[model samples]
Structure formats: structure tokens, C-alpha cells
Target: MDFKLEFGITDEGKLILADEISPDTCRFWDTKTGKKLDKDRFRRDLGSVEEAYQEVLFRLLGIN
Candidate 1:
């Protein structure tokens, strides 16, 4: 599921929400295989890192 946390400061001297959300900010995994599909791939040298980022971009663009 997608999530965005909003944060900001109100004139009343209260903290508020400022939007924050992105594919890169979170880790994703294949539930069936338990494979990491996030930055871990790059960190662990698991390969397919470019494809993974491109996949996220393509899917975000709704290009199947």
C-alpha cells in the first residue's frame, strides 16, 4: 500500500503535516519468494538493481 506522511507547522504554533512518500524511501519484497526488492539489492550486490528501479518507474507510469 502507498503511504504519505504530511508534516508542517500551523500558525497556532502546532506541528503539522508535510507530505512525504516515494518508492525509494521504502523496502519492498516478493511475498512468495521473500526476496528483497529495494535498495538492499544494490547494497548486497544481488544484481538486477537497474531493472528493479526501472520496473518501479514503469509501474509508476502505468506502463505495462
Candidate 2:
């Protein structure tokens, strides 16, 4: 998975750090096999929506 870090300021005047801010930051896997799925492949085989969603999930998980 492609990973990235972001820094920002919080409402409380504190520093906030975030990992994986967008799609293409992680790889999806089969729940049973734990095998990672290629997002590009999914996009080519499926559609843009699925790929975008998967990438968002990975980014939220902070997977590197």
C-alpha cells in the first residue's frame, strides 16, 4: 500500500497528525485468505467506485 503522513492543527491549539489521507494508500485483502488485492486490478476489473472506497478504507486504517 502507498502511505503518506499529514500534519495539521487542532481546534484545541494542538498538533494533529494523520496517516494515509487518500485512496491508493492501502491494499485490500480477502478476509479468509489474507491475500492482498491490487486496487488497480480491481479498478480495471470492476469500477472506479469500488477502488476508491477500498483505498479510503485503507487510508483510514493507516496501513503502510
Candidate 1 stretches with Cα past 4 Å from truth are 1-6, 10-20, 57-64
lDDT of 1 by residue, 1-64 (tens): 3344767888898997666455466676667777666676889888787777776678679998
All models: lDDT? 0.70, 0.60
TM-scores, all candidates, are 0.54, 0.30
Considering every candidate listed, which one attains the maximal lDDT?
1
- 53 Cα displacement, candidate 1 (Å): 2.0
Clashes of 2: 0
